[model samples]
Target: EAGVAQSPRYKIIEKRQSVAFWCNPISGHATLYWYQQILGQGPKLLIQFQNNGVVDDSQLPKDRFSAERLKGVDSTLKIQPAKLEDSAVYLCASSSVIGGEQFFGPGTRLTVL
Candidate 1:
């Protein structure tokens, strides 16, 4: 099966700017997730979706970040008024079932100057 797909492998922006990342999960996968990996740290789950319905987003920074999986296939994550601290790799992953094995995308590296 094909792995998850993400876009704009790399991005550079200044503080206070806005940026967006796109993700396409594997076909037939019912669970999707977004994670942020800061330098020198493990990936942190930002949000999770179960077929277009949000399952969890307690870790997401809602004040500056937003995400959605409208059709259960594709997802988009956006950060407005970006901060230098937001510089990190955004990863997208999907699983066939909840709590099942997941496949991750290449990730989008965002640099906030």
Candidate 2:
């Protein structure tokens, strides 16, 4: 089975700038998630989607970050007016079902200047 896919393995942006990242989950998976991982901290769940519907987004910074999983397959995450604190790894993951182990993609590492 093919693994998850992500683009532009790294990104550099200035504070207040805007950026977006893309993700392609495993075929036939039903749950997808976006997580932010800082330099030393564990991955923090940002948003979750069960198919094209949002399941959880409590930790997503609505003021700056937004995401969507159209057609319940590929997804995109965007951040407008980025901040220095946003410098971190944006990881995309997917699972075959709820409560299942997730397969991760090589994240897009963002460096805010």
Candidate 3:
């Protein structure tokens, strides 16, 4: 069996530039999530989706960050005019169903200059 997928595992950009990350969750998974982990801190949930519908995004920076789960499988996260404080690990996670353990990907590290 295959595992989760994440793209552009590392990225470096100017503070005002833009960046995007992609993820593909495991098959048959019903819940998908995106998280951001600042250095020295634990992962913080940015958004969650269930079958192409957004379930949560209260913590997401709507002014600069946006994400979507398409077809309930593939997902994408984008940041425009990236800020220095936004440098962190962008993680994509998924679970089989309610109460299922979330499996995380390798994560995409963003460095802002």
Candidate 4:
């Protein structure tokens, strides 16, 4: 089966700017997640969606980051007024269900200047 797809692979932006990233999860999967991985740290869950409903988003910086899975397939994450601390690898992952092993995309690495 085809794996997850992400775009741009990398991004460079100034602090307090705005940026967005896209993700396409595996077909037939029901759970999707977004994670932020800073250098030397493990991926931290930012948000989760089960179909079109949000399952978890406690870790997301709501003041700057927002995401949506419109059709329960593809999704997008946006950060407005991005800060220097926001520079990190944004990973998109998907699983068949809760507690299942997640498959990750290559991720979009952001650099804040």
Candidate 5:
């Protein structure tokens, strides 16, 4: 099976700007996740989705971050008024079942200036 796909492998934006990242999970996956990994730190889950509905988003920054899965296939994450603290690698992952082994995308590296 093909791996998860993500776009804009790298991005640079000024503080207070806006940016978006895209992800397409494996064809048959039922669960999707978004994670943020700062340099020298492990990835932190930002959100999870089951089909087109959000499963968890408590860790997501509601004031500046948002995400959505469309029809349970492709997902998008957006950050507005970006801050220096937001600079990190945003990873997308998917699994066939909850708590199952996950496949991850290459990730989009965001650099906030």
Candidate 6:
């Protein structure tokens, strides 16, 4: 079985620009998550999904960030009017159950100037 997959392994954009990232989770997995990792900090959960329904998004900035896991298999994360502080690696992870071991993708690294 394949692990998670993410696109545009790297991105560079100016502040106020828009960027989108894609993720395809493992087969049969029921949970998906998006995270942001800054240079010296651990990844912070931005959102989570269970079979196409949002499970958590408490830390996500609704004003500039959004995500969706349509069909419960693939997901997309978008950042509009990106900020310099938003430069980080956007990671996608998946698990079969809540609190289970999660499988992670290579991540999309964004550099906002």
- List CA RMSD, all candidates: 0.6, 0.6, 0.9, 0.7, 0.6, 0.7
**What would the per-residue lDDT of candidate 3 be over residues 1-113, giving only the tens digit for each residue?**
56778998999999999999999998999899999999999999999988899989999999999898777889999999899999999999998885689999999999999
lDDT of 2 by residue, 1-113 (tens): 99999987999999999999999999999999999999999999999999999999999999999999989999999999999999999999999999999999999999999
lDDT of 6 by residue, 51-102 (tens): 9999999999999999988788899999999999999999999999988999
TM-score of each: 0.98, 0.98, 0.96, 0.97, 0.98, 0.97
| Whole-model lDDT per candidate | 0.97, 0.97, 0.92, 0.94, 0.97, 0.96
**Candidate 2 lDDT score at position 64:** 93
After aligning candidate 4 to the native by TM-score, how far in Å is the CA of 23 from where it should be?
0.5
Cα misplacement distance, residue 73 of candidate 5 (Å): 0.4
Q: Which portions of model 3 show Cα errors greater than 4 Å?
A: none
Check candidate 1 and list the clashing pairs.
none
Q: What's the C-alpha lDDT at position 67 in model 5?
A: 97
Report the lDDT tens digits of candidate 1 across residue range 1-113: 78899998999999999999999999999999999999999999999999999999999999999999888899999999899999999999999999999899999999999
lDDT of 4 at 107: 100
Once fitted onto the true fold, the runs of candidate 6 whose alpha carbons sit more than 4 angstroms away are none
What tens digits encode model 5's per-residue C-alpha lDDT throughout 1-113?
Answer: 78999999999999999999999999999999999999999999999999999999999999999998878999999999899999999999999988899999999999999
**Number of backbone collisions per candidate:** 0, 0, 0, 0, 0, 0
- Tens digits of lDDT, candidate 4, 2-113: 9989987999999988999999999988999999999999999999999989999999999899999998989999999999999899999999888888999999999999
Flag regions of model 5 displaced more than 4 Å: none
Compute the lDDT of residue 84 as modeled in candidate 5.
100
